[model samples]
Target: MTRSRAGGGQKKIPTALNATYYAQRASAGLMITEATQVSSLSTAYPNTPGIFTSEQTTGWKLVTDAVHQQGGRIFLQLWHAGRVAHPLWHPEAATPVGPSAIAAQGQTFTPQGMQPYVTPRALEIAEIIEIVHQFRQGAENALLAGFDGVEIHGAFGYIIDQFLQDNANQRTDRHGGSLENRTRFLLEVVEAVTQVWGAQRVGIKLSPSNTYNGMADSNPVETFSYAIEALNSFDLAYVHLMETSEADLRHGGHKIPTSLFRPIYKGTLIVNGGYTKETATAALAENNADLVSFGNLFVANPDLPDRFRFNAPLNQPDSSTFYAAPCDDSTENCGFEKGYTDYSFFSQLEASSRAE
Candidate 1:
């Protein structure tokens, strides 16, 4: 199942509400939880979940246990936001760290509200190793939390994505310049991640041609090809490949098709991005994807697989409540409980209609 950041993040600590939410959708074949930060510094926005602390891990355990009780397999997406992070989350108001000191153009949501992006402090060599260790630790925490597996978040212009692309990484060390160099950090993290979960239980999420967060690689095909080639060495379970339209945002011509990497990396290929039941069927029938993930659709319909099985009408998701902050006003209420788990199943909807 695809994960959505709907009406969450306001609740700093992971709560039973989250467990209840995931349990409601536990029928999915394999569920990937929302992007979870590896450390406190990995937090880019307020209310994002973390796996660094005992409290956080224990909280996630509740989620994993709930899903397991319902006989669902789930994986946690371990993430590091890189330069997208704000000092508001930092202990001493420190600057965010990235492959380079370049500041991404745009504002990030913080506890105080929207804040302008700041030029990040370039991480030291030691810090780079530390980041890899942090990911390894995050995997350990996920194991303790009873996750079936873990997916490394190397997409969406996050920390790993920042280093993979040419525009964001401008370093002269062995860790930058050529495609091989740019892939070093990601490969290193994967190595660490594999140590905790093993390659068969590990997976990666990558956005090869995406330009989100002002990303641009000189040669996306070559860069991702090299990175994926290295990834193949690990013999992972699958590579969750995400694709996006370049028209709205991002550089053109960099959009590499999913088939391009199929031969390069021989493993399970899960595709995500605006996929519908029909399109996903076509993709599978055409052998373009091994699996397809849906986000908002799953949010509006907990029994999504069954809905597709029965060709039932899907609930239209409300955009206004997609990411709304918590509300206390009795007349105007919106939050995790409302937008997260309140979506009715087909049976519930039918029962309500009959009563009406």
Candidate 2:
């Protein structure tokens, strides 16, 4: 979940509010920070954090230190927004780059306002290689920032997904066409990042049936099957799989369940997508997944693990404040803490009831 509170600048440094937010949720078995840009060109939305600069790295150090003090493990999610990014946010107004020149059929939040995505410049082979290096450098920076590990953001119709899915990638070059060719960029990035963090400290996320950002594949089962099997070669920390959502179905996406890939993947599998405590427990009991990740639930219930242990009621997330918005006199507790760090813990609720 992108909190979008990193304050505007070329550096996009994480603020103390970010440290407070993650530290509050340090009870989770593992905490993966919001999608962080690998470079300036990776900008997709205003106020999102980046890990490319020295200042940004130092800022993340605050977050890591806070989490570690609470005995938590955190992984930085490295991201490149690719064509989903707009020139309005780029330095000198550079066009967004992708595997092909096609533009996604949607608009993205920009400084000017919500703007339709522009046709991106097709990345040359040399440029693709450079982006791989950028991921590697981001991994090294994560180490400097004192993160437990790094997860490559290969899912969610981003740069790597742009290459993996045919709808966004129409190139006739070696980088397109077959499944092997399309997966080349993802593999190269994984290889490069693993060189820095080693396989045990790295993970990759994949959303096979995701249709967000206008992404679709003619044969998602085959494409992702091969990708997951190939990952067996690397003893990565885990392969995070997102189940197809209602939004994906409404967009005409194929229903490729995580169960379909469970047998194919050889290592740790972390399943996500609208999971409740019952469903997550059932998944583990049935050996469907090694772990289950929560997004919205964690956002609202900072002490989620304790809530689950006690089978207590949860705090529902306020969708309007899911992402950060501009502060104004009309909005109370605006900027970072409204729907963020202010979510009460189960212990607090218990104390309140006792007082009453």
Candidate 3:
């Protein structure tokens, strides 16, 4: 859910528009902000927000304060794009860094336009340890920004996903070639972040059946089973799991459902992927998951929980406006409200009907 409207700059500070958008959706049980870069080199797209700098942390405080005014809880998602990032976003680095030197087979949105993925420099062991520290710093920054917690972005073919999947990680080092080795980076990051926020306020996202950014595992079940079971050692807030999408299946991904890991995971499990009220209720009723999360549904329906309560119609999402709109002037605001904060609430629609 990267709206990509934080505005372009070295800081990539969250704008007032971001505060308004999240505040409007404050009705969600728990609001998780868009994937936020943990460091300068962690960016893969233009205008995504960051948590590393003082200015960015201050900007996020606006969002947290606004949401808290409405009695809402929020978590900042910490992300590192890794090989998915292009040189356009990280000119200081030689190239994007990953577990191995291989490049993902896809393109990423950049300031220049969509560019083909590039081969990344394999990270040294010391560099990997530094990245773990970066995640720790991000968790600390989240607390400073007034977030209720922080969710590590280990899903969606990012740096952690690149290490977890074998196709993207061909190294024979301790970071690759085995389930334990591949998951080491993720565990270290989790451990580091937990030290800052403690296990109860930290969560990790995993997409075992994900096929985006050329991600695939030789054995997803075994890989994720070990990862989920290992998480039992920590009393985390929740483990967010994504169901395999149609796009994943089209890309030859294994049909490893999130339910497969429910039994293995020893804590609260949150399942996501195109869930409606009915399916979400069924999931909770059948004990398939402890909780269910909505992404796209919440995008166009800011008062989504109320809509579910009243069985109201939903506002259709405009995919074109899902991300930041192009602006001729780089310095001007790009109308982020068109498909964002402008989404009408259920009460507004009912009032409109009464007036008509």
Candidate 4:
């Protein structure tokens, strides 16, 4: 699920209510929570969730309790929007921070308005260490919130991805330029979070070819391959990869099997993006990935794993409601009521005989 941005106009989904939503769909083998900010300044979009506040912690506890009651496993996705963030979202209206002062060349949706991306302040070495501490604390908060594990958001055009790419990280210090320096922040954050969650409870999400929000690595292949190799030392629980986007096709354009990196790393691999049931099965059969993560598909179909297993019809999510509005005060108030969320599951729409 998508996460809310920090200091956004929308109020956060109450934890007691989010628990109802997640608990209602506990059939999946695993459920990944919406993108959650590690720090207040890390907010990318308005209305996104955060791991920083005590209220947020107390709120997530409701979600975990509901999922656990139904024997479901859930992972919290820790995120930082980086250059995609707008100044208005910051508490002090401070400029966003990244590996460099480069701004994303796109629009960022914020509470105030759709703002143009602004050049961010490059982080200092000490600030980098403090950011790693934020991630560590976020991981600890996730455990306290009752999540089974935590997934570091190192993909898309987020802060970690920015630091991993040379084009975005033009610094000369120990944190930029070369491959080693470029990936330093990622390594530090991983190590810091791993120290709290342990190897088995920590997973990472990465998108090597993604060029979203003006992210372009001069040598993404070399950068990511080296990154995977480095991560081997941590023995992480899993590595989730969003394979092949518009950015990948433009740069290098090499479509390697998701399994290509499987042998290179020693951990469970989850492949996402443009995957079908057959494709997911093939990925598992070929040992390309240990698991598959479906975003839009799963968002609409709460019983996705069951639908796939039983060959049941899937629900088509209403694109309008994906990020349309906040959940209403009443748990029964569906997103569709506000012209936002709509999906007809097999159990609710198709013939009962065809339902699983």
Candidate 5:
């Protein structure tokens, strides 16, 4: 790989070593892969993994095989970054597509120093139809790669969320304009993906009040309730909600009334977004969520549940090695293997302490 460009290497591309990373954490009842691109055009960052090619599918198969060998369940997080995408990762090197021509107000890490996001090409109705096919194809590939199921990355101002939010989607066609129209695209994708993985195994991620990518709805409570209601028809395995009622407000989104959605969405509800072990336990006990997804806690402690059960002190995460982007596109180990599979397990650390 080439040298890290100035201020780059933020998103590490998953590699064969990722199999080791997942395997180490296979003691968990469930594991979810990092959000992987459905196609080259859908990629928002360099070195991100895609499921569209044989090579990528084979790489994923290695990860899945490793996880299953340990009797663990895992699901692939399917993503299309939409306007967060830049031309660098697009096939033929073209501008990224969005529900509308408006650009997201943020910078994306490129081979060079962070570049301002480009104004995306507004997707035509026909292109929107094509994306449904892409999601279906991605789910089928995930099945072939041995994923237990697939999680549609519909949250955080990506393609599906772009279509869902009124500020981002300015279309007058069947894909946009009203609440029903906005919800239509997501439902179609759910339908398409379920065709490959079945409704029982399919899940979705939603950020009802996220403003990470300039996302805000005129009526977030009503807007999101309509979307959640639509999912009830699908019998989805779960709905992963990013509880953003508390966030850095300067980023610009409103508080999502997370409590209001519990009745609207009848499926298994999973909550994420900066949850601590204590808060997670509280959320489940209070019936705020059926499951909680941890990020750094899981990263620093591979056998995370064990630590939680015994009231073990948690290991702090290393901020520097969270993600690695290869400057020259070389795939070997991505960048540094520090924050990934190299993170010390509690057993390993305890053994070292005894040896010392």
Candidate 6:
């Protein structure tokens, strides 16, 4: 691990990012861009990137160019915090909306101090369509910015997940009730995004029993099983699963194995959550997962795949600077704050593996 200039411990910033950061870690089979929002209303933090604006798309061009320069394939993760959003961080501060009006239990970080969540206004059918359009536009923007593909952020108790969960969605519209009804919103979203990027260039992520932001499902197994089958109809790039642990599982819910859903889903299955190098390797070796996504490991060690292959030591992440705005301030729209974008991948790998 490199020494932090802060003296005793690692600095709260990820210096290894940038062109060199991706170049150093160019060995991964695929690299998914960090979770990026689809619109201004989707903002949830100080430095997280959004795909809604032209400037944001331009900023991401630099990133994809760098990864490609290093011979790596990258996909952009399209996200919307849903009810997890804080009003202070958005243009409509204190007015963030969700599927239902139920307020989340935890405090949300905002420009102001942590504040209690307010009940989100239920989205009307027309508004729901608008949201889908936003996602479609984001997918188009991603392609315009030169991303290989886009992953719909359906997991982690986000907006789409909220609509999927019975506890979070109490409406009586086409978007609420019955497993089919609840998952309708997400399916529609996938369809909309696919229209722009094609099913092969699009994917979806889901958490069967995640409780983040107070999300819950009456029957996650049935709910997700049904959802997975529906996802298969689209023939998406992959169905990324976030397996819930024993503690995270709710009552009346069944634990689902990635293998069990394999038959239902005819596409690639990428599994995530609490996965280590050994576990990731075993998942691939055992055919349990087609790909494994390392969250923090990828965050701290950009060259994580190579590090795992060669058993190189890894760098721990800096929790403080993770959300801290970069000095250059471009982070207001994109995650990168400084001229961090100016840095390029290692030149040696590029010269040898440059794409035709």
Score every model by TM-score.
Answer: 0.91, 0.95, 0.95, 0.90, 0.92, 0.83
Question: How does model 6 fare in lDDT?
Answer: 0.72
Q: Residue 128, candidate 1: how far off, in angstroms?
A: 0.5
Please list the C-alpha lDDT of all candidates, in the order they appear: 0.82, 0.90, 0.88, 0.78, 0.80, 0.72
Error of 1 at 335 (Å): 3.6
Residue range 91-200, candidate 4, lDDT tens digits: 88888889888888778776656778889998888989989999999899999999999999998889999999877889999998788888889999999999999988
Worst 10 residues of 3 by lDDT: 324-333
Pairs clashing in candidate 2? Answer: none
Q: Look at candidate 6 and tell me the lDDT of residue 60.
A: 73
**Model 5 local distance difference test score:** 0.80
TM-score of 2: 0.95
Mind giving the per-residue lDDT tens digits that candidate 1 earns over 81-142? 89988898776777889999998867877767888888889988999999999999999999
lDDT of 5 by residue, 1-356 (tens): 01122111223334557778789899887787788877678767656677777677877898899998988999998888899988765656789999999999878786666889999999988888888898898899899999999999988889999999998998998888899999999999999999998898999999898887788778878888999998999999999888774552657666665656888888899888888888888888998889998877888888887677656677888767676654544546335566766766666566456556
Q: Model 3 over residues 272-342: C-alpha lDDT tens digits?
A: 99899999999999999999999999999999987887778889889988887444344646776788788
Kindly report which residue stretches of model 5 are placed more than 4 angstroms away from their true locations once superposed: 1-14, 245-248, 327-334, 348-356
Number of the top lDDT candidate: 2
lDDT of 6 by residue, 1-356 (tens): 11111100111122224435455556778777667778677655555667787767776777778778888888888888777777766664547778778876677766576777777777778888889998999899899988899889998778999999888998887788888889998998999999998999898888886777777777777888899988888888999998766646643334666666766787899998878998888889988879888766665666565556556566666555344432323232434533232323334454345432
Greater-TM-score candidate between 4 and 6: 4
C-alpha positional error of residue 343 in candidate 1 after TM-score superposition, expressed in Å: 0.7
TM-score, model 1 to reference: 0.91
